[model samples]
Target: MAKGSNCSRWVLCSLVKLVFNDAYISTKIHHRQVSPLRRPPTAAIAGRARVPGFGTRVNRVCVRAVISEGDKKKTMVETSKELNESAVESGGWVDVRAVITIRKKMKENLNEKIEDQWEYVVNGMGQGICLQLISDQIDPVTKSGKSIESYVRGWMPKPLSHPHIVAYMANFKVPHDFGCPGAILITNFHGKEFYLTEIVVHGFKEGPIFFPANSWIHSRKDNPESRIIFKNKAYIPSQTPPGIKDLRREDLLSIRGNGKGERKMHDRIYDYAPYNDLGNPDKGEDLARPVLSGEEMPYPRRCRTGRPPTKSEPFSESRIEKPHPVYVPRDETFEEIKQNTFSAGRLKALLHNLIPSIASALSSSDISFKCFSEIDKLYNDGVVLKDEEQNIIDNQFLGNLMRRVLTAGQQLLKYEIPAIIKSDRFVWLRDNEFARQTLAGGQPKQELHLHRMSVEEAIENKRLFILDYHDMLLPFMERMNSLPGRKAYASRTVFVCTRTDYPYAADGLLIWSAIKELVESYVEHFYPEPGLVTSDLELQAWWNEVKNKGHYDKRNEPWWPKLDTKEDLCGILTTMIWIASGQHAAINFGQYPFGGYVPNRPTLMRKLIPHEDEPEYEKFIHNPQRFFLSSLPTQLQATKVMAVQDTLSTHSPDEEYLGQVHHLQSHCNSDHQVQIMFKKFSSKLEEIEKTINARNKDIRLRNRSGAGIPPYELLLPLSGPGVTGRGIPNSVSI
Candidate 1:
């Protein structure tokens, strides 16, 4: 029965091996069967253990032929396959599958954690590097990959590498209701590395730590490649207040220092202590006394440490001091005081210098009245005129003085005279003299006559003196006209002569004649015109007849018109020459004298004495009456005849005709009227057309050999239309 049961077990295992394929387990089970530990010792144990109720051990012995090793090996492989199948049925592979799944999940989780941690590390490393760069420290390595290590090393306190300090930096939560963390690191743009102590972030004693990543690094050198540097130390919290709690996990993580070499933490401890305690007593006292004196002082020892102690001590009575009064010396003696006043020479000099200043000061209307009063006093006191250099105070002096004062004042004080005061106020003061001259009542008759006579006599005397003086100065005048700049003063004399008109007297005529003679003589010498006959044609003809009769320019006969009329002759000759010298020549009739009607007048009656050798005159001698008769035609032409003389009639004289002639003469002489005439004549196209038409007619008539008046002669009648029938002859030939 035991042998049968064993055979059954082997068959079941073989069936199981056919169902599951597990080569590795099957190989392991085959090796175990071949070992001695799996030998039939189990057979001896089976026989010996059979006692009492034990079942009988089954043993089977069969004679077997000798088999080859290869067959033996094949049987062993098959048996091992059966054992492996048995192992699979018992579920031994489940544990191995579970272990592989768990391992894969763990690997994925670890990779994610590494990635997250690397990001934080990179950010922190970048911030630390930037802080070092801003502080202008040389980075240890040129490669960007070493930037994190370099920066961490740079920020450390004295005796501690920057990396060591970074490693030891801590962060904690504040005790207050504020939700911020305890500590922070501040890197400033000015290359300042600051450890911000007692920071009240979120209203808490222990504040959050902030490692700034985005702050710009400002460079110290101007070049682009120069490293940026901070101006101050980095800011980090010194210590946390006692009793702070409820810190965050992240805060704690941020505080953890990266493990580096030896930590020299004493530097941080010293930084937290009061500055006065950091140094020796003598050094501290020397630095502190100046700040406590309340006078201007240097910075105290504590000020170097970020927080300066407050200067809030109250002053005590012991610190007060007493005051003293001041005393001034006084002067005596009236004479001494008077000496202090300006002396005459000094006053003169002061007045001379201050004239301009005073004028400028007075230019302001507000001060002008006072200045005027002062100036009047000075003038009354003879200060302005009594000085020997009074002539120096001419118009130029006053003008320059006023200008300088005004300019100086304007530059110095920016004070200027108002425009109105500068223009009109001074003009009134200088021009209004009537108030001083006018009296309370009319003058006495005798006094008035005396005054009138005195004025008249003064004028007449002055006129006579000027005439005599001009006569004596005539040679100088002739010399002046010949010179250039040398004649400037003489030019002034000429101006006075021309501007001072004395009508109805020979003075104006005499001066005018002299000037005209001088101008004509100069013209004739420089630009002469020979064979120029300047007298009226009638007078010339009469003179010619007398000369032919041997009555003039002959030894037998005397010349007519005496030397007294020499000036008149000169004037007539000068006027004729002046007029005839131009292309468009016309005499101004009013400017010349008339003749014939008043033949016996003193001006015309004067005669020249006869020369020794003579010839008897016959034509004018036989007809002395006829000599005056020849002038009748001229008289008739110049006179206004009454048309009613042939019958008995009463009418007004031809005043209108005479007036019109006067008006025409006046208009012809006026520069304004001549300008108006020329402007109108030039501007009017119709008038130019009429003139051209008339000229064309004249040209055509002349071309056709026809007798016709010239256009110019025809137009001459239109020139004095209103005075055509006046006493002046219409046919008065030029």
Candidate 2:
């Protein structure tokens, strides 16, 4: 037989035997006398003697002793019961029988209380290798009963025998009702510590607790799977002291052991944990136990965060001696590119060029664009320009459109971000909380609902910026566009003001303020430019000067749908969406060729700072935004390599407010806006399909219908390549 086949056979046999051992133990317990269980101490004093079977069988023997004691009581209780019955028949009260019965009942209650204190450790970790302290034990220091906190503090890890072996301790708190064993699980392991002698607990009233020599086992540091497999069997310290016969911890090639020799192993209820839990050792304990705070420990970043840096952004700070150049040759000459991409004059001439996709998307907000297209078609075919009857008919059409749009707006405002993003998923699970809440009165409405601030408290508590963008801004823009088109447009010069919900609900002034803030933030992060708007007064003054200069009129002139009234705040929203959604999407596709959210943009603010309340927060779950910002600079560099430097540097921070609007209008018309949007959307779907196909090359997962890439991994940027019709040639600079 092949070596691999033999290995597989061995593993299968071991698994079978382990399963059988668990079943046998469970069945044996039922026949054996039940009694109180005593849990072991978390640690023993360092450098203590390793007595064979002492640490291993102490708890087991304690239960046996309790059972023996219970049997003695049961025998006395039976004799007392007979005496009590005779006394009752003779009509005489027997105090001896009553007292013995009471004592027996009291003894049973004591054993039950002890049993509760030491529950079996049930976890998904292949087997429970450790005992759990379910209840408070006598504090070694104070001599009074105390919680796990006090006990954990008293037992400190001993210094490693070797200089290279670095040891650290971690505590796992099992959550209540999670089917976990209640305990403060501690594992003292070392890195590069092949010859770790033993781990001893410090401070105790009784003698020190000692583990087996070479018990400080460390798995392969590089292998993630090895670290994940729990240390299931904590072998008992052999009666004989450490010598040539004993194997070193490093001798065990695998975490589950090599299954080599017929080693004597003890299997208990806690040993064969059914749940296969990770991180937590106990299910029925409080999970949110505060991380034990102490002097800053020299732990590695990956261990703490649980997220290693990607290839583009390595965690180490080692600087390259000769950095790779970002610039690459492109087809277009620098001067040619300068005119087409940089000057911003030509691009700014057409509004459709700037925001075709956005304008097309907004069409769904109203029926006027479609109706007007038909209306214009009829007029062109040979209708008179000015007809009273035609005007009245148009007014009626406008009124009905307004009524429906308003109703749709009302319906759109109450939907949450999750409901919007995963609406299909919600509908499928009819019993989902969001679905139940939304479809309460009738069948679900198809119109997109805007999220109400009152109902957004749950998302607010998470404090994620992307979630806020989804829950508030996206829906608001959809609803706002649904308003009556022309009259709403005519109500221009509405006093502009700043509001928290800028770009979505706030007037032009607020949206402009938001745009300014975004530029200022970019400048702050990248250019180190001072004197960017630092105060509200400065921003307002800047806005006033720009508005008075007729810059707005110049920017809006290129818009093709010249309906004469200037209420179109599309400039502000278009810019906002470009910054919020478009840039990240483009960057992600440039890197991973995927169509999901990109994280780690170097230019964006990081949201993964330690939470104020959780001083010792362990980030096992990485903040998506952190990755989004960290990777942004690399995306910009990639864009530079693609010869798109003009996109980065053309719009000076000073000109951003007016420049974006002017540039967008320069290249687009109303009809082209709808066409451009369709092209872009179609392109995005194609990219998504390509991404799916690329990953599904694995034959094992290909045939499974629902086995596409995981939703989290499928995360793509909101934008992609070819989004803009204009060729953004490649460069290699940032």
Residue-wise lDDT of candidate 2 within 332-372, one digit each (tens)? 11322233444443333221121222223434431111222
| Cα-lDDT of candidate 2 | 0.23
Best by TM-score: 2
Q: Pick the candidate with the highest lDDT.
A: 2
Lowest-sum lDDT 10-residue window in model 2: 96-105
Compared with the true structure, what per-residue lDDT tens digits does model 1 show for residues 1-734? 00001111111112111111111111001110111011111111111111111121112111111111233224334423432233221221100000000000112367554643442353233322112111111223421111110111112222111111112121121112223222122222222222211111111222112221111222222112112211111211111221111111122222122222222211110111112323222333333322222123212211112222333321210111134211100100111112232232233333333433433433442121122333233223322222323334445547577456534533222111211122233321221111111111111122122233354565565531221244445557656545532221111110011112222122223323332544344323312223222222322332232222212123233534421223433453344222322111112221111111122111111112212343323534655444333322221111111111101111112111101222111211112332343234223323433443454354343321123211222112123321111122111111
lDDT of 1 at 719: 33
Once model 1 is optimally superposed onto the true structure by TM-score, how far is the C-alpha of residue 636 displaced, in angstroms? 15
